[model samples]
Target: MRQPTLYLPHGAGPCFFMDWEPPDTWARHRAFLENLPATLPERPRALLVISAHWEAPQFTVQKHPAPPLVFDYSGFPPHTYQLTWPAPGAPLLAEQVAGLLQAAGLACGFDERRGFDHGVFVPLKLAFPEADIPCVQLSLRADLDPAAHLAAGKALMPLRDEGVLILGSGNSYHNMQVMLRAWQSGALTTHGLDFDAWLTETVTQADAVERERCLIAWSSAPGAREAAPREEHLIPLLVVAGAGGNAPGAKIFEDRVLGAVQSAFRFG
Candidate 1:
């Protein structure tokens, strides 16, 4: 009954809920996200989402039974702020997650006050609009170290066999500066494509040891900094990679958005 894990790109700030001027700007992403539930090997019992939008001094798990929406983004339509995806939180899974991390010597805590940020809610809204699944949120470490996050993912690996879905929600290429230019020109930059190609090759390596090595040293990849700039969005992939154990990953979706190559992966 082992469940597959996912690394997804939750598109920029409320894009799914709004209309872009080009009309087709978000079409590909929207279709890909909406198809997520069907793409799964099986329906998951609970989802443990690692969000890029949330960062804490240490790892934190959401414990609230009814998690609220955080609306972490701004400058979208007024209705966008009012959006809600009222998925109940999984407190039991939170305990399990904490135990796993603590057992691995990773300092972790629980939070009753946290809510689902865009990273969790946006994709969930499209993927599972019913909001019937019990979901929990895990915060990224504020320090944003690749190895630490990868280690954290390794710690949580047991949850997959326990029927908990591990989903790392972040963008593949998250450079805002280049995104704007691509949005205007309707063309992806070479830096973004180069980095994305490197990521694809790295993650899809048949050898798990080599895949892990490449991810741990991800910064050295061509155009890595130009594509990510800040590592927040990219770090989620490391978490997913570690949780994968010996499982290999494949690019489930790949497309151009705001002139950047966006991709998603599934591990088993």
Candidate 2:
């Protein structure tokens, strides 16, 4: 069976492993991640993850055979920095991914030294706690072009049938400035609702062509800018959406975090 492509919300920096004023702040999201593997068709042979954290001038793949963790986020609990997910790196898959992108006329490169950032480890630690799967991490292009990332994803569609689970790790709504203000003020803001609704509709559209078209023009959607001041956090979805091909997408999970609506999507 072909592995499904996913776009998941990787919550605020190691939030799942720490305590918050509201002790259960990350409980729902953590549960969602924990339950993710059971929902898959079968155990994946490898995982190809596109994270919001890393961006290169060109599309890049991590080639480190024994990859380490990157403590990308700051000011978290000291123990959070020491969290571990010792999954083996997929150097061969890195070459395969680069080949796929290059064949699609997309610029690609490799990094043998870079490690998995929080975007990859934080969530995967929950979903695949054993960390036994061979994993490859791909970088978003620094340009952050939606169509380009989508094309990169389309180029990678072959991996699905080969037992590689394609995952896009990002938050659906990622305007940190706004979210922080709302959190500090204890204000209940629904600004992300419109964009969340629009995004969910676009990705879940039965017509793949239409879905791609809407995603390319996503900046014009209601609350688009407010939901993503910087597109990095949302760009991974474009890749997952592209890899989806003709498969219909479904909203697998949804939650309100820090006054912003976050969601997870599965394309198959």
Candidate 3:
């Protein structure tokens, strides 16, 4: 069986760690996770996360058996700073990924000092609370160009066959313009809903060629500029889609946030 790879629209910082009580989006977030383990193919030997937070000048890998905390976000509750997902780090696989990038003639770097960023820990803590599986995070490059990112992902393609669950953890309808708007208005707006619909139709079309084309031209999608304004969240999707290649992506979880954001998709 082809191991599955996910491109999840992880909610804002530390949202996944919150419980079901406050009647916010976190409850739904947790539920999506509760059902994910069973939905995935038998667990991979390790998980390779392409987090939006860890961007470098080029591709970089975390190389350490036990990683530390990065606390990349700020202004949240103080307890948020103390949170730790504690998944074992895969320095061996990290070296392997680095080697692959070098072999592919791409600029690659490493940081044994790096640790879990919320782009990694937040959704991961929910998806694998046990933290038993070894995890490796590949940082994004400063370049947000779609074609460049696709090549970066293709370089890591070999790892997929070696039982690494490559996950692109970022948002789909990540309109920072809308994120702040949602926070203030406390409701989904027209642009969010429209962009989300366009995204669903584009991914669910069942045409490999078309999906690939759409991803390359994603910035042109309806409300695309407004939705992504910054392409980091969307770039993560390119990694997963590039890994999928000719395969059709499985729709993992496509849902709304604040009734507007399109948090969606999983691909093989």
Q: What lDDT would each prediction earn against the true structure?
A: 0.90, 0.94, 0.78
- For candidate 3, what is the lDDT? 0.78
TM-score of each: 0.97, 0.98, 0.92
Q: With candidate 1 superimposed using the best TM-score fit, by how many Å does residue 149's alpha carbon deviate from the native?
A: 1.2
- The better-scoring model by TM-score among 1 and 2 is 2
Q: For residues 120-164, could you state the per-residue lDDT of candidate 3 as single tens digits?
A: 888888888899999989988888778777776777777777888
Candidate ordering by TM-score (highest first): 2, 1, 3
* Residue 198 Cα positional deviation in candidate 3, in Å, after optimal superposition: 2.7
The number of the candidate with the highest TM-score is 2
Using lDDT as the measure, the top candidate is 2
Query: Cα miss at 83, model 2 (Å)?
Result: 0.5
Note each model's CA RMSD in angstroms. 1.2, 0.8, 2.1
Give the alpha carbon lDDT tens digit for every residue of 10-63 in model 1. Answer: 999999888887898789889998988887778889999999998999999999
Query: TM-score of predicted model 2?
Result: 0.98
